[model samples]
Target: MTAGHCSDSGPFNSDGSVSFFHLPWGGIVGRRLIGPMARPDMSVADMGFISKRNPDIGVIPSIRNTDDQEFPELIIYGTLDSDTVGSTVCKSGYTTHVTCGEILAFGVTVTFLNGMEFNGLIKATHMSCGGDSGAPVFQFAEDILPGIFITGMVTGGSEEQGVCVIEPIAKLITDDIYVLTINDPI
Candidate 1:
């Protein structure tokens, strides 16, 4: 899954029905576009999923530093549905790699420089910039489990420096979609 707008930017095929996602580790993953919600103001969670599957890559749930130098990739034990203000949240993006900050607000609506307005977002003090869209916003659950709980995907940055808006993962998930947790078979 990835930010819908991220697909909007695309390295699209001539038909525009598909996009190529580049990996920092070196490779390309072609994904079929599953169109995002159409809204006049974009108040909904800014996310979309790809229909294609990559069997070569491990499907185990995990999060790691982009470089895996500072911290190793760890399994995702499960998910957290609720978030509290002042709690720490971290994000890993194409541009920012990994950064953490406190949750400042919820149900935030943000307007990007492109004049695209996005709502139903979580506002955080994490440092972010362009190309960081579609990053994973997660919480470390070391106290309860030795893993992270993915909460949201980055929609974009806020006007305030060091702030970004995240679309809660819960809003993007559905009955047909299931996130792989530790309990799930790898």
Candidate 2:
């Protein structure tokens, strides 16, 4: 129920230093060409056909606090343009770095700075343990951007799937939160 930006998707130390999501292969990216497709749902689970983008090096987008300092605001987006609606989409986390494994996920609508609203979702996969929060959730595809959208952060999980929630990129950026676009430094 707290509100803050993510730090990264690695682990924290009692001392300092950090471990981040090293996307040597980079993450995925998605963009809206003619705006979102008419059948947004049709593109479900078909991230490979979308686009791809990578996360910046050494910097993992997260929502953690360090030494009493909160990082900048950040959000991830897919290729679905304004025409698309944010509903019933799948997201992939770090631990289970698999293809099309995320289901039954939805994002919350947050208002942006331009008075726009965005829909984001919380990950249902228990992929993140203790050190895997802030791991970006994206889709990879050919002829498309690599990093589509950063689904959510690891808010914590239960016996079921790992409990991770994400704030929509549209919301963070529009709201004037220090946001880091995909492929940007963490």
Candidate 3:
């Protein structure tokens, strides 16, 4: 998934556009964007879909740790209830890589420089950066699975200390869209 703010930036350059990159065997494979789901203000729903995928490449359903080399085999089997708050959340992104922090508050409002404001966000300690806007947020537990997907992306926050503002996954689901689990077939 990608940030709504990033998706709102374009309709592509006629030739379409390279959306994501996959690095395997030290080589890069670029994926293209099929479409995006952006809110008018680009605050709550910040995600996009990639249209391209290489059959030869393996897609792991896991979040990579900061080390960038390890896949903990994490599976998002479930999500925390909405009223649940003040738990620890972790995320992996392009800029800061991987980091974990505590949830400081919920149902908060964050405003961007573009004059777009997002409400009902999860506020947490620092664990993200500028380029990490579309990173997934999860909760790590002692269970066999490494983590549980809790939110969609790291929408905003301080990159210096790692404070993060997240777009909760619950808020993203609708009558037509929902989160899928590993048990679901690809």
Candidate 4:
């Protein structure tokens, strides 16, 4: 799941209609918004989905950490348990790119400037900025074939050091839907 603030604009046109998905490299990917799901109270989880199966834009389970090379593929086979704590984690996003840190706290509550309070969060030392709201937080180890797509960082704090608050993947799962993951084709 993502932070609710990321999709606050609704990804729609001024006429109140869904907008087409534009690829970063300038091409119509045929992706249509399925609508965003968020708490009216502007709580912790902010999630959305899109459908691009018609033209099959292709989904790559990878993240770009450096501008000098290709994206590093990550095989996501599972998720981190809610009780998981004191684990090393990493996140990749548009702003900060990629950062690694440790989980400092779990099942914590935080209040945003909008006066919205979110509970059951995973606080870490990872770095993130404004545009990094929806970036995936995961764990990668040497022997692990598929990393765990743990959560998404919603907010960042600590003026001197980079601290991020993440919405745990465990809390994002509902009866209707869950996050998607994939294994490397090799």
Candidate 5:
């Protein structure tokens, strides 16, 4: 689960191969997971996946929350019902770390300066940097569950305006690729 534009930028090889590192400086690497209709060379849908790298590295189903001393990493239970316009959402990226904001709108279509249009995007007021393309967009749900819900992934954003665009995770879930969750629904 990464933005298609991320592959267009970096983090992935030319053949759609990607490796996930456990730490920011790369401690443990994760296996390459395949995605559906991934834009390897383009950023049309802003969704992409990396091919197989090392199958030995272990991966976990969690979201980063450095502010929480009790629970540094939040477990990913599942997604909630449908997010509304006023729903509070947060994004986690290495550049910005974690920024929280409300959803402005959904089903948006943004066109970049290079004339590439990406549809099915959710617009939010959170901040993101250039290299934060594949960041995770999620919402913490303590009432329904103690963990966070993996909502979507960051695609593009306006650094000046302090806003970001995300693509819903539901669109990326296929028979093969999926988010590892307990209550995962197909």
Candidate 6:
């Protein structure tokens, strides 16, 4: 996928139906949404750009078949857990594109209809404000090209501590990683 920095500084739209600003790493190239999210109501308009400093947009499947069942790309984000106390995590959102903080120790495990369970942790602080639900998360890596593996979804952040919980990507999908196909892109 191609990407570029925000040319216009006004109202933003991330819905696939609408063309929004996506400044790729270092604002070198720009990309328009050629596909929609797995959920019809979701859109790239919901998420914003990845900062040049952070320099990663989660993960985009390197290869896959058209008939395969997987998401070509995945984004996940959430707030810090209140009980967590250690290394910090990063997040991108509409309000604040990049925010980082420690993870809280307390959280709840949610089970999906497929019997997949996600052990979500409350972030120690609010990395996201309003308009951040559905944001994406990435596991940071220094050498990897993508440098991140799309992990889960950001549900919400609390007002007091800014703790947000995440739904692990494994729990959301049937496969370990999304398989993408060039013949018929999703």
- Give the alpha-carbon lDDT of every model: 0.68, 0.33, 0.65, 0.59, 0.68, 0.41
Q: Supply the global lDDT for candidate 3.
A: 0.65
Better of 5 and 6 by TM-score: 5
Taking all chains together, each candidate's TM-score versus the true structure is 0.79, 0.34, 0.74, 0.70, 0.77, 0.43
Residue-wise lDDT of candidate 5 within 67-175, one digit each (tens)?
6577677778866534699888877777767778788988898898767887877888856545677887788887854478878888878978778888777766668
Regions more than 4 Å wrong, model 1: 25-43, 53-55, 66-70
Q: If ranked by TM-score, best first, what sequence of candidates would result?
A: 1, 5, 3, 4, 6, 2
Off by over 4 Å in 6: 1-87, 106-124, 176-186
Backbone-clash count (model 3)? 4
Clash-forming residue pairs, model 1: none
Q: Residues 1-186, candidate 4, lDDT per residue (tens digit)? A: 345565456655565433334234222564444333432334435444433434434555554445425445565665666455677788876566667778888877877666667787888875654467767777774576434465554554554556778777776676775555664452
At residue 168, what lDDT does model 6 achieve?
Answer: 42
Runs with alpha carbons beyond 4 Å of true place in candidate 5: 9-44, 144-146, 182-186
Per-residue lDDT of candidate 1, residues 1-186 (tens digit): 777676665556566644433465322465333333321123465666654444454445776574665455756776676469988888877676777778889888777666777777788885664577877778888785447888887878755576877888788677987678888976
State model 6's lDDT. 0.41
For this target, which candidate reaches the highest TM-score against the unseen true structure?
Answer: 1
- Quality of model 5 by C-alpha lDDT: 0.68
- What is the clash count of model 2? 42
Of 2 and 5, the candidate ranking higher by TM-score = 5
Where does candidate 5 clash, by residue pair?
4-46, 4-47, 16-51, 17-51
The root-mean-square deviation over C-alpha atoms between each candidate and the true structure, in angstroms, is: 4.1, 15.9, 4.0, 4.6, 4.4, 12.7
